[model samples]
Target chain A: MWYHIDPSSGTPIYRQLVEQVQQAVASGVLRAGDRLPSVRDLAVELAVNPNTVAKAYQELERAGVIETPRGKGSFIADRDHTVTEEERLRQFIEAADKLVADAYRLRIGSERAAALFAERLAEAERRRSGE
Target chain B: MSDVAIRLAGLTKRYGEKVALSAVEMVVPTGSFSALLGPNGAGKTTLIRCLTGMIRPDGGAGTVLGVPVGPGYPPTALKSRIGYVAQTQALPERMTAQELIGLCRGVQPRWNDAIVKRYLDLFALPMKQVVRQMSGGMKSQLALTLVMGGQPELLILDEPTMGLDPKNRHQYLQVLLADSIETGCTVLLSSHDLHQIERLADRATILVGGRVAVSGAIDDLKADEKRVRIAGAVEEAVVLGVEGVRRAVKEPGGWLLFVSGASEGLVERLRGLPGVTGVQVFSQSLEEIFLSYA
Candidate 1:
């Protein structure tokens, strides 16, 4: 319910919810035992169709991100959902493709791009180590 | 669910020399939220009137909720089950919202008082205020509330949020969507607000010159229609020769090729073309698609 769904964005509403729930799970914000808002409650809160919310919940259930029990309600599934290697590679490739395209446009040398990548990695590592 | 809420077959109408409708045909599915999009004088109002039995078409025939529609006008039974909140709707100036609600309630056998109370509470509209004293937005919302209170099977709203501010519009649409979800109301809302349509509607029918220009699931249309920017020395003619290409514009660096509901592999095919050094495929938003035919 805390998540926001931008109606103007090209992305579908149900997909937005799916991604938000996944992100929250990945960020440790939504624990395995946390209960998601009921379909009606979330629909009213989000100002979206209950069918859209229901579809999102159904997708999340199919993906093992949540569980819906009969006579009760839906809750986060008790499973460790990790990002697949294929998905990570796809993300990295998409980022790299865009970077390469921009570099080609700006005539940036490969050496400069490599050095920039390394510098950013070191900065991220330093932050991770509390530096 | 497959049964249509409204259907028109080669429906045509003319006012003097002007053609209000030209072979206008469309289908609004039961329990589905559909956006009827068109510019001014695009026969949107004419079509609505024909469906509501308020006006007789010059040619063709149609049906609303399985009731036949024609020149003589629709049956009273069919009219009662459908709710239509016209853009030009007017309320009695001296009547209070409460008083008017009472008057309207007397005519509707299936009217729900709870819905009236709930909508009044949501909009915070004073029940005692005369309609003429209300703002345009307030009057629009009041009319919609009155129509919706009847809990009709099919609801047609003609730009019901035209005068509402962004916040008010969002709230009003939210309430409407919630009601639709709860009651499975079949809604056909004609509005130029593409943002609202994109958010709330799953399907649409774009009208151009009183004819259906585009109609289908919104997502499929988005996927099919894309602006492909490819940087290469490839011949524009050859690329335009490719199937599904709607428009091809030659830019300094490349060509912006618009593919209309093209297959997914078309972009990949363009990427594989010789001299295609850089390619960018831009998926169109609903507004862009609407503008293309509008």
Candidate 2:
């Protein structure tokens, strides 16, 4: 199983599963064409309601992260050029909001937050290009 | 099949001058796994009993699987379609698992031997062991197996995993999850196991003082209800003025505002409040939310 859910977490379980699958896809742990477990199978394995698992799969499908061709099961989508610039910015802004919120909570000044964000972005870009 | 599995309106039960249930209203849709939450003496058991037809309600009416359930309404016809497991099961001590299964099969109108066999085998319950000698976990397994034999459309379970170890409890819940998925059965579970309920139940009803304090789809409840932390001293009146702010409590550094319907827009409004250095929003877990109502 590549996904685990924390029921006690503030995040809802389906959303948690959604994030886990998204993270796995981003990290290259679950590559395109990898077959994900069926909703029933995953629910049984996780001891969660099957509806919850189905909701996660539905969200993934809507996001174009996974494709479920009828009778063939669900597989990670091949997204070599599917991502739009608008979509990219939308996702980035959602993440940046959390980063900003955390920075405020930690009392980190705007300068420090900007510097840390730039440093991490440079490292991520370097790793992505195999520099 | 009707869309609703259970519907109770003005459900009231009283015991000798003491009210067990006070005009409780609840609705459980078909195929939904719902958890009934309440503190001790909060009428959880009385409500279950009323729905199961074991006890009569002084007021209100209910329907189970479209069958009317209330005073003067015998649940005889409905009983065959419902499986009930009380918190403290009263299985005959001398009867072995096989014997109980045989007895149930003889009496149940919709008994399915295969389901019983499958559940007992999956749980590895000793069929020959007498009820008195079996472990608490095994007894629970046996009780669940016998109940499943009827292929019930609605399963009413009361603290079904009370004394079992964590592993056994997980096994029991897994079987239920699979069963519900396979059959689309509606389940009304009454238990104090918030963690398990949080994972298993999609809808929840929190009862306080024999009345429903909160009830909704668990996902919606968790999404809409949140706790916001203010960095500095803030006026309670001002915090309460924010849209959807239900309650406010003072904390060490600031005020913890319990806000319902605190979606992104509402949260931004909270952040813009005066005398607030930082505003952190935390979604309340089921246990935390239940405590607020319990």
Candidate 3:
């Protein structure tokens, strides 16, 4: 899957990659054994320094979100063994907080927010199954 | 012995009575892309000239690629491995792109014909087109091909994309960034294009009014500088006195404060104040930071 980067965004590029890759794995868009793009290839595609991509991959590898198999490349790690339950929940909240804050700004309440989020999850599922 | 590709210490330059660069200093690490940013008359050109040993600094001392620089323009042997793309660079009007490449091949000791040919085709420049008839974009691509072909240890570019359309400017920046990545060449690019600098440069040194005003990693600098919008009213006097707060201006329904960092404690203090409903932090773009300094 292709990744998008906003060079002008306030978040650092490496941090953005961590979040994106985590979300992709969580959503099952990327599964265990799925290979991630090589550092040089991703950097050229994103038009950023290769060092930045390397840093992101290193962080992912450290967190056990992805592992680099010798001579092959980085691949998504098995979710159950990747991170402790507490750490996985922390990552989930970090991503969820942003979504909640956006909806809160529009005066959207929790029940409606839940419904909206469900629809989004269904939409994501549909796209993934090639419907 | 040092890995720094360029270093300036209290470098000063004067033109008759007027000063161009005044006690300016900066260091560009080897193999790093450093953007030399400034507005017009900010001594960008003067600094580049000094680094390349094309002009003598009236004071201070510096080095480029480990070689001592200048009581005056450096001799050919010292400058042989440096590639400089002058802001007002021009090609021979009667010379075709191929013929000019041939001419450079004869003089440049490190010339690589393969690179020249590769970039020429990459830019889709007509090899048979006379230099005089080429557009600004084509001419710059031509100049850059020759420069990169020589495989300089240090590549100094001054406003390399001065007069080009949006597409050409973007493409030129992409090629430049990619080349620097592939070769690990030490690059010091002088440009007013702050966005491009933010994209390609790991470090930035901003010159203002003949002095180096701000210099550091672009990421670190951007992190340290922030703009925040607080909903509801704010006492301008009270906000002004807050620690690390630089400036505060009253806007509709709120006050926009320019603060130096993303300190959570600062946000908590603002939230605790009367008439403050919410606070939103914004990271200042490179252009915004440039304008503020300039």
Candidate 4:
């Protein structure tokens, strides 16, 4: 998997990398047990400092989103067990805030926006289950 | 080992009546990748030269890797451990890359031919081609290879990526980054590419008018300096009234406020002001921060 980082952004590079991995996991783009690129490899790939990549990986490991056994590379942790209900809800709310604000700007009514979200959620569930 | 790799205090230098460096104070922590940034004639090269022991500062003091470096202080004890790559070097024009590598290895206490060969192969630099026949990019890579082969504990790069294209530039930085990671080597690189530096450096010291304008961890620097957009017809005086707001510029619908020392309360204060319909805070990029000082 490829991770993209915006060097010019005000967000710290490590935070950006951490957020990317979280987003990828939330979207099912990265499944549990999927191996993450080693810290050195990812840093070289992004042309960033290796310590920045290590910091991101360290944060992810602390959050239980990824795990690295000795002599083994990092892998996405089993999300269902690793993430608490409260943590999952917080992540959902964070994603929903953007959609909600965007809908309000576009003048879409709450009912229609909620219906659209439900449809998308059902579609995502269907796709995941089918796989 | 001391935590500091380089320290400068009141380091002053003069070049024929022109002041190149004036009482400059800067520090590079051990194992940190640092970028020394400034415009042309901003004393960046002068400072690098001072740190590398190429020249002595007329006044003040400098130390590299725990050894005092300045006038009257010989660099013999420190020179072997530090790698200095200038923007241009007078490589013997007639020598092939292989021969130059052999020559550099013979003088250095530590030389890793494998490291040189690895980069040579990675960059596809011709080992048999003499320096006179190599292109600018190839020669640049060769210079870097020679420096890295010595396994210096400190790498001082002065615009090391001046001539390479984007792909080559990335490759060159990778080698440096990897070496730093594996060996815990400290790097003090001076470059004009803030975009690349932003990604590669953990700390940055922006010099202006031979003075240290801003020097700190990049994250803290970005956090402290911010731009805020306040909606509606806000008066400049009203925005300036806020404690942290430094300058207020008129915008189409409202005003843009340049703020320094932006604490959490600063944003809240901006939102509470009258006539403020909305307030959005943005962290300034490294380039913007440098321009502010310039």
Candidate 5:
């Protein structure tokens, strides 16, 4: 699975991981039953502590976004078994609100913000389709 | 067994009236990975030397692994149980990496060749190359391998990653952290590299002018000290009114505030204030913190 992180963002590293994984699941880039890399491997790739990656994974598991099995690795949870659409939408909107507030504080206009987000979504979709 | 692997109580060291260290108290917990960080001449090296029995402290009494540490008490047993790698390269010029490893194994009572070979491979050190001909990074790796091969219960390293390239530094840090975890060895390392310390150290002690300016778990230290930048004139009262702020300073165009505890919600509150253009939560880098203390 592909992962992207923006170090410039003030969000903590673990939160970044959590957000990226959630986005991947929401966009269908990470399908259910796809085994994710182990916490150690992800930490090495990201040059972060394994404990931080573990914390992210634990939170994802708690939210039913991922599943862990003994002696096996974590995998994306079945969508039907995960949170309801209402709850997922609520989380997405909360994140969007934070991003919008930050953009506004930086003097980004509403039109520019909306256009930039749409461009990013299209780019992501293009990449997924190419894959 | 005491929880502390090393303890210093009011330890003082002076070099001909130039006070190197003054009445410093520190406790290194058993099996904990601790990093002592300071700039040059901050007495980090002096403190490490005293702990390793290389030099005597002018005052104070303490113990290493339950053995009394003072004039009459030799740290013989403690020395044997602790492996030390000095910051400077100290490998014999004529000896090859493998030969030095062999020599160290002969001198140490409890040597493990299997571990030595594993580390040799892990670090990708050329076993046949002469120590004198080895690159700076290779020599550092060999020195670390020699110490780690002894499998001491306590590992004391003085800037293990010094003089290494970025890749070598990362590799060395990984080995150090892995060794600490697998062996449960108590480690006391002195380094100026903040990013590496952030990654590897479980706890850190910041030494400024021979005294601990701050010391605690890495996360706790970061969480307790918040870096806040606000875009307008900030009153002392306004800053003090912030629940977690411990210190505040107004820069030319912004205010830098240090919060003593978690200030997760302070950003939102600050954003709603008039004339506030930004509210950022930041953790001071080790270099920044050191400079501020200086």
Candidate 6:
């Protein structure tokens, strides 16, 4: 799976991997049964510790986002019968709350912050539609 | 998660007449980002070499990720799992950056071409330029690229930012920090760049004269050593004699004191001292603390 990481950010590595994989799955960039790189391979590619990659994979597996076959490799799991929309929404809201809190701490006012977030969402949608 | 990636107990090393490392004990938690910091001749490099299995320890037996580190340890299998980047420029002069990385990919069990390309691009590295023609900073970056592209379970870097310009150093550390964050890979880097260490490391071990002067979480060390400024004609000796003071330096018209296990009470004590006008608790920069050790 393709991934990018920022070292200066306060977010931990495993969390970044988990979030990226989740986003990829949600966006259908990673389809059901799509074979992702092995933990070792991904670790090398990302210049990260193998254990760190393993932790991310483990978390994804626990979330039913990926499956691993012994001696084979990890692959995207079928999302059709996995997490429901309500659960997904719950997770999304939780993340949004954290973002809002961070923004609040940075002294971004509510109205402007909401407008900025909407702008970002629209930009993301446009990019997704290849506009 | 509790599995130890590296364990060293009573580890010692010497070079001819000088003791480089003396009875050092350390445990690098699995998937933790740990830094070793020390002044010149403080044995940081020697400790790093021992941990990487490049040199044998004199007085201790330990395991690096369950493989015995001394003689009779599984050779290639264990060695392959470790990525080591030394302070010195060690890349072959004839090979270009791309060629060198490609060579590593061929031998390493785990290699990521995409990751390698991304790092090269991010660092603005010249892929086709020969190592001999590269600048010092470029060579250092190339060395780092080689090790990072290998993607070992444990990373041991000895002053990886040395010889790099400020911009290159920032880029290098950014990549290094990103790798640690994204991979949860265990990292043991030795650097005199205290600010970088403070920014990147989860925990740190300070080596002084071949011994562990201090070892703990970075936050813990910073909290323990409170910077106290006493504005008065205080004698350096008297300030140093304060119960909690670890070190004291005479500044213009005052004394800057580094007190271990500092608290509000300690500040009050300093303020109450004879000839003291103002006593304030300040944060000690990592550089200041490192220099104190020296």
Scored by lDDT, the top model is: 2
Tens-digit lDDT string for candidate 4 (B99-181): 99889989988898888888888999888999999888888899989999998989999999987888888888988888888
Number of the predicted model whose DockQ against the real structure is largest = 2
lDDT of 5 by residue, A41-81 (tens): 67665555566678789999878899998879999998656
Which 10 consecutive positions of candidate 2 chain A have the poorest summed lDDT? A122-131
Candidate 6, which segments miss by more than 4 Å at Cα? A1-131, B1-3, B231-242, B248-256, B269-278
Tens-digit lDDT string for candidate 1 (B1-294): 437888889999999999888897788888888889988888899888888878899998788888778755778787778999989767888989999899889999899999999999999999999988999899988998899888899999999998899889878988888788788889998998887787778788888888888887676777677778889899978788777777788899889887786766787778888888987877677888887777
Give the alpha carbon lDDT tens digit for every residue of B1-294 in model 3: 368998889999999999999998899999888989999999998888788777788998888887777654576765767899988867888889889888999888988988888898888989898988998878888888889989888899988987778777767776777788788788898887776677667789999989997898887888887888888877888887788788888889988888876688988988877888989988777788787678
DockQ for every model, please.
Answer: 0.40, 0.74, 0.45, 0.70, 0.25, 0.04
- Tens-place lDDT per residue, model 6, A22-108, is 889766577789998977567655655555577789889877799887878898988745667887678779999999899989999
* Ranking of predictions according to TM-score: 4, 2, 3, 1, 5, 6
Candidate 4 chain A lDDT trough over 10 residues, lowest sum? A122-131
After superposition, which runs of candidate 1 have C-alpha atoms over 4 Å from their true positions? A81-131, B234-236, B272-275
Q: Which has the higher TM-score value, candidate number 3 or candidate number 6?
A: 3
Local distance difference test scores for all models:
0.83, 0.88, 0.83, 0.87, 0.78, 0.78
Interface RMSD of each: 2.2, 0.8, 2.4, 1.3, 3.9, 7.7
Model 2 chain B worst lDDT window (10 residues): B69-78
Worst 10 residues of 5 chain B by lDDT: B285-294
Model 4 Cα RMSD, Å? 2.4
Q: Residue B83 of candidate 2: its Cα lDDT? A: 90
Report candidate 6's fraction of native contacts: 0.00
Model 5: residues with Cα > 4 Å off, grouped in runs: A1-13, A16-29, A37-48, A79-90, A100-131, B1-9, B23-29, B60-63, B66-68, B71-74, B231-250, B262-283
Choose 2 or 5, whichever is better by DockQ.
2
Q: Write the per-residue lDDT of candidate 1 for residues A1-131, one digit (tens) a residue.
A: 67787766667778889989987875567878898888877876766666678889988887778888895788887764544567657867997999999988999899999899899878765754555
Q: Which stretches of candidate 3 lie over 4 Å from their true place?
A: A1-5, A15-31, A62-64, A97-112, A115-131, B72-75, B162-171, B230-238, B252-254, B269-278
Score every model by TM-score.
0.85, 0.90, 0.87, 0.91, 0.79, 0.63
Clashing residue pair totals per candidate (backbone < 3 A): 0, 0, 0, 0, 0, 4
Model 4 global lDDT (CA atoms, 0 to 1): 0.87
